[model samples]
Target: MTKNNALGTNVIAQIGILVHDIEKTSQKYADFFGVEKPEWSLTDTLERAKTEFEGNPTDARAKLAFFDMGSLQLELIEPDQNPSTWRKHLDEHGEGPHHIAFFIEGMKEKIAIMESKQMPLLQKGEYTGGRYAYMDTFKDLKIIMELLENDN
Candidate 1:
């Protein structure tokens, strides 16, 4: 697994760019930056894989495909039939970097640290493999912070 120094702790980390179309954007980035083919996954597929989110016996669909851009991972998201965080972001703001996710082990502690600094969390809920927490730091910048935990 990849790791980086965040808030003085070694954390799983990546920079992300939110795009409207995955394949198109991935190609653009690859051509412009001379990068290789990107790794992709659908959010619905991920959600379906997680029993915690499934709750019922049904096929799950994901609206996201991801590309690894060196140290950064660019994620393309499209809202499927079901409601998703990506859907909400696209609905609210066009296409852009919706959030900067900092993956850490202790979500609660990370949240507390942010809260202590007076940064209010915008969304708090459960999704797919693990828990998630979000905080909006800027509206014009179209940036937010995401705390994610994966079962893996």
Candidate 2:
């Protein structure tokens, strides 16, 4: 990889899609892929996740389903009626591909680099074993970029 590559790796770790009905959509995807339907679950509570949107704390949550596809994962998200990037995308753009994610280390540094390049942080949260940040890179890349840093 190039020395200037802010994300460190070029591999896409996951692709997230926003959907209105994760249950139906995930089932469809599972059938299409010939895999068992993955169980969908809600994100952690705001108290645990410490989720933020537009720089402020938020209670926004989503139902999430994941499918392992070789080197990458396919994520389906159905957001609650809250002010989050996921909800915003679903409202404005309708259900569709939302973001492509990269698993990386030094999340803070990577976020700083992306921000310096004009991609603002739209949302961020902590999961059970990791944290995630969504960068607004649509102006240049035509897609949101999700940075995932797992504490394994």
Name the candidate that leads on TM-score: 2
lDDT of 1 by residue, 31-128 (tens): 88787757566543444443122123223344566666666566665545444455566667777767777665677777777766666566555566
lDDT of 2: 0.96
* Weakest lDDT window of 10 consecutive positions for candidate 1: 51-60
Q: Lowest summed-lDDT stretch of 10 residues in model 2?
A: 1-10
Q: Give the per-residue Cα lDDT of candidate 2 at 50.
A: 99
lDDT of 2 by residue, 45-150 (tens): 9999999999999999999999999999999999999899999999999999999999999999999999999999999999999999999999999999999999
TM-score of each: 0.61, 0.98
- lDDT of every model, 2 decimals: 0.59, 0.96
Model 1 / residue 63 / CA error / Å:
3.2
